[model samples]
Target chain A: MKAFTTHFKNSSMTTTADFTNTSSITLKLEQVSKQFGNLTVLENLNLVIEPGTFVAIVGKSGCGKSTLLRLISGLDQPDQGTVFYDGKIHRKLNGHARVMFQEARLLPWLNVVDNVQLGLGKTGKGKALEALNHVGLESRAKDWPSVLSGGQRQRVALARALVHEPRLLLLDEPMGALDALTRIEMQQLVERIWLETGFTAILVTHDISEAVMLADRVILLDGGKIDLDVKVDLPRPRQRDNPNLIKLQEDILRRVLTIPA
Target chain B: MSINWSKLTGRITGWVLPIFLMMIWEIASENGWLFSKILPSPREIVQAAIDLSISGELAKNIVASSERAGWGLLIGGSIGFFLGLVNGLSRTADRFLDTTVQMIRNVPHLALIPLVIIWFGIGEEGKVFLVTLGVFFPIYANTYHGIKTADPQLLEMGRVYGLNHWQLFSQIIFPGALPSILVGLRYSLGLMWLTLIVAETIATTSGIGQMAMNAREFMQTDVVVLAILIYALLGKLADMGVHFLEVRLLQWHSGFRQ
Candidate 1:
């Protein structure tokens, strides 16, 4: 993890994006409410995400975390709300945002490089290889997704999301399905990449520690609203065995589990 | 030269049973214990095959049959694939078109031979029509099945990745549907031969079916048997061809690997 941090620290040569200015793309969801045939999934929720900030939304199943992601990505419409990207109001998908799903969801027919290039459009060959290299999957560029391990497939998914350099990157429990060790490694990988590119990153996960690990701010969702928002003021590459981190993680977990259905 | 005993044994396994059956048939024919009228012996059939080939009659019928099947398959397969694409992509198309297709598909295509003869009048058109009808249903049904059953998760991924409509169809939907489409193709090929034989019942002067029907009129059981063997060979060859194609195209999918 520390090694990747150093690598990302020197990643000025990797990206051409102008990340010098702190003022960049921001996500604003105002009075968001969503329902499906009389079942309220989200109700009057409001949130603001500044650029270059990492935020994780932790919740139990059916807590509307995935619904929030769908609304943010323009996959689902809010019943009574508005979502603004940068300064523009979000209506239809404008190709400026990308999402990483829990299942990797790599097209089984496409090879690793082709899958990465999918979001980049037709002439995305060179950049796709670069993105694959970022995820440490350059060796498997020509291999099919069916032959890859579960972790590798998600890495490819991450690479695909990052290849196009989206202003906003939405991760819908991307690491939830991975094994313990692989999940830790992916968290580190995502951290390094996010630290490097500084894209607005939003992660929706069930794991409390995962929220504390990568997210600058952890929001605990209970019912249809944000019940708790805690900032991780600790420095990057915080030790896994740190006492303060464990306390914060435990506190968040307690809050999440104790919330009444 | 060193002998590859295992390889040789493996290669010979497939041919041994057919060769054994042929030998038994030859022996029965030689003993004069077999019926000479209804089922001509294997040796007599072979003689008839050679005679037909020498006179170029076998080649002519083979060409005629090939033309009918080839044209029908091309037309029917293309139309079915198109309809499948439209219906698979649009719910409105499915509502408008699929119900009608489902209704028509339940009817046995061969039962319509009399109607086709009336409409097309014993010409090449009637035979082609039969083969086309036979080929249509499988391709349409399988293509629809393939498209409808495409992984919804993959479709979601495609949407998130900002793929346009055409890109989504080509990159996601088409490859996902290809395996089922190939299965439909194999079934349709079998039906093509079956339908052509049925179409030949109209007493047309050409094609393998007509040749067999013509031979039956003269008690030339050998020639009749030869034509049947030709149909069998043609069906087997078509199947092998499709199997080869599946291997070539779907080497990535483990289900199609062997």
Candidate 2:
């Protein structure tokens, strides 16, 4: 484990130097209202995330959490207002942002390294190898994506997202399909990478415990609006079983359950 | 130093039944329990094959038939593949061409023999045209289906990663549709032989079908049987070729690996 940590640190140092221009981004969504036909998914939703901050949006299904992430990523435009990136009005697809979806979505025809290279767009086997190593998948570089476990595939997806060195990383329930142990491991890996890279991350998940475990601030959404915005002022490498963390998780869970459908 | 014993055994087992059946047929014919006038014995068929080979007739007929099939596949397969690609990738192309193609596909290609003969006049052109028509639809349908049903999620991911149109089509769309396209190729190969057999038997002078027709006029059952066996062997060889291609190309597919 110690050796793995040191190796990760060494690789990240090189990546940091290579991507020195990729500073973190500030995201601001001002009165962003989105409607699909008559069903309003997000209504005048206002949000501001500081650079390098990890924020998790926790909401029930149909609460427009994924839609909000899509809006921020510029995949979908809000009907009413604007999305600002670094105080500039962002109009088209957000070039500085990369989204990790619920499914890994790796090309089945390509091997592990080739799929990672897809993230690079052009030829860069060396850089692809580095990213694969970051995700501890360098050994399986030549293997197909179909052979990987759910967690391992998601890790490759994370590596693909990170290879671009995006200023904003949007995660739309990336770990939602993982098993309990694998999900925890992925959470730790993501947290460790986020800490090292300092990229702004916005995770949309239904798991409150996961939100508390990873994010600096947990934003609870109910009926297309933010119901609660709580700051998690905790130390790094937080223990899941820690009394304070558990109490906060339960408090958030209780609040989430109290909202009427 | 080590052989794959199980694989070897599996191959040996597959041949056992066919060899046993041939032996039975040979013994039955030798003992006069079967008449050679209707269905010739295996030995007689082999003798007929040797005679044809010695006279160079078998080689000539085989070459003629193969060339026709090859040319037809090259032209028809190329047209089908490109059309399928266009329709699969673009809604406009699909709207303009898909309905017409599907309507034409419903017409039995072999049933157009009368019109084909009239249009091209019993020459090599008619046979090649019939084979081309016969080999086109399955490929077009399968390739289009494969592309149309590609995982939208993967395409979305490709877009998010900033792949341009050409990159997305070459890297994602083409490989994703390949398995289905190969299925079309295999199906089209079978149709290629079937259409050629009909076309040749109906109006040709140089192919294996014509050789069989000539043998029938002289009551040479052995030569007729030989021709039938040749067609069967060719069809099997074509299928094996496609299977080899699938194994090589779809190594990443779990079903094709090993």
Candidate 3:
């Protein structure tokens, strides 16, 4: 209910971790900051992603990119500031929002498909299988998560996040644990799934190119603030070989690398 | 499944020492190196088993002991499980009763046989009470520990799901505590047998333990040995029953694999 002044810095370092314009918004955060005891992780953050948009948050290790996602996902509350979804205060994740963690975090006791359907109140077994099928893991439905490959496990996690038909999807470095080849494959799978689902996605990643390739707009966060908000303007299904994407990636990388060591 | 005897050799290896000891006992008895009054021959024990079977005494005693154990498990285990859940979930209840229960746990239930006899008068109530006391603490302690030790991360997941209190407990806390609860049940079943034996020996007029005590007075070593064997067999069967139930109930668990 309080008016929050937005600070737009000339350089990448001074803006809050999330920076968005009032001109177009679906999800918005204003003057958000979070602190744990003495350490400040997010400071006066502001951002917006339009309906069915994919936004990538890129930051160095301690810049609170994941923390920002956690706040958005309602996994954690911001100590200060308000997050709005569809003009309503984003409070907690209901069936409307779901998060996929980097570790997959599948229930080990559950089979792959059951793990996908976990905590889906009143959902049918058939629909659960359909979600697994959508993730191309129908054959491994009855298999334990422990037996699945890392890529397969992540696929199961993706299915789980999708099963509830959430309007918003939060990815917290979901591919960080996968090998290089697996990570690329999973990135492609995720991109295709996001396009198919038409769900608003906010991805937090350390990989600059991952942000550029996957996000419609990429925000580079440094020092608990958004350093730069680069619009991809690149076409849907953008390829890694696209010159503009490559240039954008180079630019984001240069901005990120210029941060104080 | 077809054949893996080499892998099973360690399990089979344990039987060798027991068989060797039994053979030595038989040889010693046959050679009169041991007094027949003190140590019955294996054949004598077998003959006593046949005699008891003819009289239907062994069957009746086994049934009696088993019934006591069954009742003890049903009542004690259920109470312990529910109470454990309370102690695990409610800090106030835990604070009030935990120290009291710990203090009571230190008093050996078997040592209270005379008191139980005086209270219940060598009746079935005393025997049942003894069995219940024997089985209660282990199940309660383990269930409490299990609930306490449930993964906090999974609990965070439950919170993210917006599960209400009952939903959280039924879906998350209960399932998480199941492995430990099952372990407790197995241990309690064993204790049930132990307590039933002590109770029957002290107070009851029937059951396997009573039959053993009766045989001892008459110097019927064969009957005593038979009763002891029945007790061992019953303990093994009770354990197996609980184990089978655990496997069926928690087939999803990783522990079920081995």
Candidate 4:
């Protein structure tokens, strides 16, 4: 993590002002409700995230965790209430935020660097190269996305998102499709970057252990409402096998499994 | 050394059957086992080609045919591609134009040859018109399909990444649809040749098809055979051109990569 921070700092010094100023963001959702047809997905949900905080929303299928992330990102609007970003009501697509979807969603026609540059909007090949370096994928910068493994593709997606130096980074099960080992490596990479960059991150995941590993606070949703909000209160560079981490994971898992359909 | 030998044989493999068949035909025609009137020997066809080239007739006909094909493809392909872009990108345009395009596509273009002759006469215009009509639909249909079916997920990603409208279309939508559009192009290229062959056969003066018709009148079976061979060669050449284009444009596609 120390080596990664120093490397990122040295490389990022040459990038533009937009890439340098990684000012974090705060989010507040008040009485937010969303519905598709007759089915209410999120019902008057209320939450607040501090700047530079890593929060994970964990729930079963259709519990509306993903919907909440979408609302925060302003990809979808709440039917009842407003989502405030840094205390201002943001009702449209959040321009200051970027999402990393479950699928890498990298354009197959573009190579690694070009895909990252998509976040920078036609300029900033240098910034994009630095972002790829941050993800340890600078060597594959000229290679097509199709040639990369699933984990590698996600890393490129990470680079694309990070190139923007977004105030808020929303990850919608971004590591769900990865294998166990790759998932761990990606989590480490994301953790290291988050610590270095200090961007607010809201991750939606089904994995309890992942939530315990990465998030400072884990928000559990049941029937479109927050059922539990647990804080890790743990140190950085968390060990997966730590007894406290294991206990927290088990506790979250039990709570998730015991929730009635 | 062994690997090189196998590679060499691999290169020769595709030509082996065609060459063997030509040799057999040559021997059979020489022995009078096959009637020369029905199918001339390969050597006779080659001699006819040589004679025509010497007289500058073959080159003239080839140039005429190529110009017709090129003009038709340029005009027809542009119109089809333009219409496809407008319709695919705009729901209003799609609703207004797609049904009419589909209706016209159903009418056999070759069946319009007589009508075309009456309208434009058996001149260059009529033949070019037929080729144009023949090549338009596949390209239009394929381009439309390609644009319409561009991955929605990628578009959403583009939007989230703050890509503007033009960037979304150019970077995400167009590239996504390209493989399908190329398929359409290949299909239309084949149609271009087929339509030209038919139109030229029915019409008045100049192309390779006309040369074949002239030879038939004079009982120069070798010249007629040569025309057919030229068409086959031209069609092969057109297919190779499209393949080359696919290789160049879709190098990022795993299917197109070596």
- RMSD, one per candidate, in order: 5.0, 6.0, 5.3, 6.0
Every model's DockQ? 0.69, 0.57, 0.39, 0.66
In candidate 3 chain A, what residue range of length 10 has the lowest lDDT sum? A1-10
Write the residue-wise lDDT of candidate 1 on A80-133 in tens digits.
989998768998876778889889988877789998998676789999999999
Residue-level lDDT of model 1, residues B212-252, one tens digit each, is 89888898999888888999999999999999999988877
Q: What C-alpha lDDT do the candidate models reach, one value each?
A: 0.86, 0.89, 0.82, 0.89
Q: What is the per-candidate TM-score for chain B?
A: 0.95, 0.97, 0.91, 0.97
* All candidates in order of TM-score, best leading: 4, 2, 1, 3
Give the Å shift of residue A19 in candidate 1. Answer: 6.7
Give the per-residue lDDT of model 2 (tens digit) for B1-258: 699999899989989999999999999999988899988899999999999999999999999999999989888898899899999999999999988998998999989999988999988998988888889988998999999988888888888899888988988889999999999999999999999888889888899999999998999999999988999999999999999999999999999998
The residue ranges of model 3 lying beyond 4 angstroms of the native Cα positions read A1-25, A121-123, B1-17
Tens digits of per-residue lDDT, candidate 3, A1-261, equal 011112212223211123232322278898999999999999999887776778899989999998998898888899999999889898876667778888887776668877776777666577789988888999999998878899999999898888877778889899999999999999998888777767788899999888988887788888899888866666666778999789778877887888885
- Candidate 2, residue B210: the lDDT equals 92
- Judged by DockQ, which candidate is best? 1
lDDT of 2 by residue, A37-58 (tens): 9999999999998788889999
- Clashing residue pairs in candidate 3 (N, C-alpha, C atoms within 3 angstroms): A12-A227, A16-A225, A16-A226, A17-A225, A17-A226, A18-A46
lDDT of 4 by residue, B1-258 (tens): 357987799999999999999999999999999898899999899999999999999999999999999899888898889899899999999999999999989999999998999999988998889888889998998999999999999999999988889999999989988998999889999999999999998886999999999999999999999999999999999999999989999999999997
Which model, 1 or 2, shows the larger TM-score? 2
Worst 10 residues of 2 chain A by lDDT: A11-20
Q: By TM-score, how accurate is candidate 3?
A: 0.89
**Which whole-number lDDT from 0 to 100 does residue B138 have in model 2?**
84
Cα deviation at B68, candidate 3, in Å, is 1.6
Docking class of 1: medium
